[model samples]
Target: MFSNEEMRDMVCVYSTENFNGRRAHRIYLEMYPNRRQPDFKIFKNLYDRLGETGSFHHKRDSAGRPKTLNSEQEEEILVRVAENPELSTRRISMETGVSKSTVWKTLNKEGLHPYHFTPVQNLLQTDFPARQDFAHFCRLQQNADPMFLNKVLFTDEATFTRRGVFNFRNKHAWDLENPHLVSERHFQHEFKIKVWCGLIDNYLLGPFELPPNLNGKLYLEFLQTQLPNYLDDLPL
Candidate 1:
């Protein structure tokens, strides 16, 4: 439901940028910083529709009943979602005087989907410096040797237990793509088994199991003993 002027501006930017939706969106934001910016999919859809029909509007279905939602109503739905992405389709329908199906249809048409939030460990303030230092060290190593990353083994461990933790499936963040949203949960003392994995030089290493309570001693022992077993076949 963009105005003629706005649509024209979008078209100008999109064409100039070689039809890159993301670049067109950035230019649109620069042109109208104060306006509510539409998602990248909106720009692409508008451009495709214009190309197919020579019009900025959607063609009505001749065989079926009239559209449940008009262009203005669809835009209203999008605006409401942008304002509050957590809003459910039922709630949006109630506020916008449309059916839940229509609201869902509008959002689906715009390529919006519900993405669940990922569970992450809560970080302490003191951890920030270490994280930054590690990132800087990695960047320096990459600059020093082009193959440094390829030779380095990236390893991570995750704990699993019977105890029920946060249920991320119950909550969702609706968007055109994964927002990489995370909900921090403080560590809780529970019976758990840790699984470790590593990757280097296109080789996948160990789904090795470790005791629930890990310490520097146990970790060093694993590196000095068990780690060698896996590295025997590696070029390292």
Candidate 2:
């Protein structure tokens, strides 16, 4: 029937055996405004025992990111990743209900090189093997089967563009931006390209050019004239 606000005692209690005179309206806040909830209940202990609740809140540090991954969680992630080869690490994490970071740390610690693919490595110590080269129907065919590779003439074409020369990397190298590397640098400026046409057996064909500026007649004539010289008279 009475609200929390209206519950304040309208008149203060002054124990009197015989009630007399006008009752005083309590003005002191020491007397709770809402008798419904007094200081004793709102906050616990002595500051409140003295009838004062003090400040409602205090300042604290902001939330922070966790410092490190737990070992067991990482192991679980590694096991799941190994079992499901079709699934990526992120996908494996979702399936196993473990964190992706744990999976990465586990993989790294296990010496797994996610980028490299070599069956010999077993991804180093990682549960997943680096690669498993499956033999399909095409791979089983004579042309692809290693035992019969010598007999089949695997032919291919090569064209020369005489403008770009390929370069092999040096035995030792450093980052281009490093001061030590920059001071000991060497730059190449060569323009000599030569392509070779060949059978996989190392029998190479010519690196001939098309006419300097092609014309239909010249192209056809070159084919007719050069075809004989290049192909040589076979048992035709």
Candidate 3:
């Protein structure tokens, strides 16, 4: 003795699960073992309607509870959000002629959630060809020798600083000579010392200090001198 809307809801679920209407009615009956099943003709009609519309939701009833945002308005909200992801919820509400809460619910249902911004390094125009060539070479090496990666010596240069971490409040000193709180800041410009290092298999190599005015020839000489010592120690 289910109401018309309740019967329609069951029919919708059935049609979605079992695409065939006749089979859906049998399963729907099995869903409620004790209760009397609805008429097959009515169930078939609802199933047909569901197939045509491809929607499980019941149609908006004029006499029933009023809808703040109709299907068309909800779709409009999705479109606006897609066009500009940075639009705020309030802005989306205004654009779609719906309330903020409605806009939020719509977006939530669509698996869209708010996220905070994060900073990352962007690729330069010159990097594209280099990246592609590196990838191609790696693929060729992978095909030629599976253990090629283990044989490679990865090297890079990084800087270490003598400056200790200090907040804005500590940077200022209460010296009466210069009440403006200015001090000789050597760490601001010349605190960093650059060093080069290499890694192979399980061994860590030298953190060799680079020359004060390092150039391409100096770098090549540095590598030529340092790499042989590390490579000789490698296991056969």
Candidate 4:
């Protein structure tokens, strides 16, 4: 570690001598006759440092692996996460002084993982009673006949549009255990295709493509015509 004054003197001398290391060394020796002489390479090194960092002093060593966080830092991170399980690693790193990678490693070492949010339809309070009644009806039917559920056709529909679906990759809650996080999705107006599928008695039904603007008339027509074709093979 060369003194700032010595490094400054060497840089000045090196520049004044047309960047000739030998001449700069001789001039530096003359300037500091009583001071101990640095190695010949020191002049060139200091010159390069000044040019690169605009400083005579050495830059902090960054070549090796980054230093590990102390116990206190790790504790602070864990405590912050405990306080807010929803806190992301990036947010934790910003709040704390730890690097993002270090924060992630710390969380992982503590058995914490990021659980993505599941997207669900936005439901109204009124929908709860109907859902419960349906569930109760299904249970009663199953009690009456164990094969009732297998005989019933379970159907689902998905809408695809020019505007794609929501991406849930980045929506996550970080915790030691699965938080069972869910996000409600509201339907938006767009030109879309509605696809329908059904299942009954372990048999997969048609992945039928329904009309974009399916009204009661069109749906009834589908059931009267297209649906019968699919049901012909199955027992009534």
Q: Estimate each model's TM-score.
A: 0.53, 0.30, 0.45, 0.55
Of candidates 3 and 2, the better by TM-score: 3
Q: Candidate 2, 14: how far from true, in Å?
A: 76
Q: Tens digit of lDDT per residue, candidate 2, span 1-236?
A: 22223222321221221111122113323354434322211222212222343322222222432225443344334434444444577775665455667666666777765664435522455433333332343367755566554444343333434342343343446666745532323346433333323343444445565555556798579667875576563232
Best by lDDT: 1
Candidate 1 Cα RMSD after full superposition onto the native fold (Å): 11.1
**Model 1, poorest ten-residue lDDT window?**
58-67
List pairs with backbone clashes in candidate 2: none
Model 3 lDDT per residue over 39-113, tens place = 444455555545777643345333422237665456556655654678899887665557788788888987889
User: Which residues of candidate 1, in runs, are more than 4 Å off?
Assistant: 1-28, 31-67, 70-72, 115-129, 160-192, 228-235
Rank candidates by TM-score, best first. Answer: 4, 1, 3, 2
As a whole number from 0 to 100, the lDDT of residue 173 in candidate 2 is 65
Model 2: how far is 173 from its true place, Å?
4.0
The per-candidate count of clashes, in order, stands at: 0, 0, 0, 0
Error of 2 at 72 (Å): 5.0
lDDT of 3: 0.67
Which digits, one per residue and each the tens of the lDDT, describe model 1 over residues 9-124?
A: 77888888899989998988998897767776567667777888898765434343334776556766786687578898878866777778878788898889977677798999
Candidate 3 lowest-lDDT run of ten:
58-67
| Reference-based lDDT, residue 103, model 2 | 63
